[model samples]
Target: MKWLLLSTLAVLLALAIAEGEVWEEDDHEVLIRSERGAKNQECRYAKGAWTECDSKTNQRSRMLTLKKGNATNCEPTKTMQKKCKKACRYEKGAWAECNPQGQMTRTDKIKAGSDSSCEQKREITKKCKTKMAKPTKGKKAARRNRN
Candidate 1:
């Protein structure tokens, strides 16, 4: 009957409108950090934009929320992208994920042995400095005014 078809169409239209309204309210939260061992910063999503907050020194955090159907692929900004790709921590022998802007996700941390490499490099540089300084002084003294 014509009335039956009309009723069904109306129901479908109402359902579609309801679904759309719900989706507008849907929001997701994700936390981004600059490095591992840093505090787990918190980011909140409710409206449409991503907001980044720095609550701790030397740590960066961000929050993102997009439309229900939009992709959640958080991309880092240009400077952030390079900085994020920089090695953070190697976990289980694999690098952790970072935001598109290079800000670290909840998972990235300083790779093991990273600290040791810094220490070793410092020691080597110190030794090289001592050796280089000794030879440079002899040449400088020769050029100085003689008594």
Candidate 2:
């Protein structure tokens, strides 16, 4: 029983070491435009880490590998995060549209602009009307009616 347990432990350890590991012996090839390797084959990008050559995948990137079925993926770095933050195509500026009823809405942030002129100098003349929700019940209602 002890021997069987030992054998099982050893096998698990070996499998853990072998999984998702890009070894020096793997003949990783640099392809044009991140092409994925075939099943059990190793392909890689010109730069970066991670190799899923033994698995199933077709997605490829520079210095990355694809497995037998799924596409290749790489761990995102700071650069990727920055790219995502600035991905929006709109330019950094403010735009305002005022309706005929004097309802004005200011432009929100598209990107962080330093010297945006979204502010207006003239004061608006529109006044909004407010209605009371609940009128006074007894004495206040009598007073309001007299007023």
Per TM-score, the best of the predicted structures is 2
Candidate 2 residues 54-142, lDDT tens each? 22343323333332222344322211000111122223333345566745543334344522333323233333344458754888779
TM-score of every model?
Answer: 0.15, 0.18
Local distance difference test values of all predictions, in order = 0.34, 0.38
- Give candidate 1 regions above 4 Å deviation: 21-147
Per-model RMSD to reference: 24.3, 18.0
Error of 2 at 23 (Å): 17
Model 2 lDDT at residue 117: 34
Residue 52 of model 1, lDDT score: 36
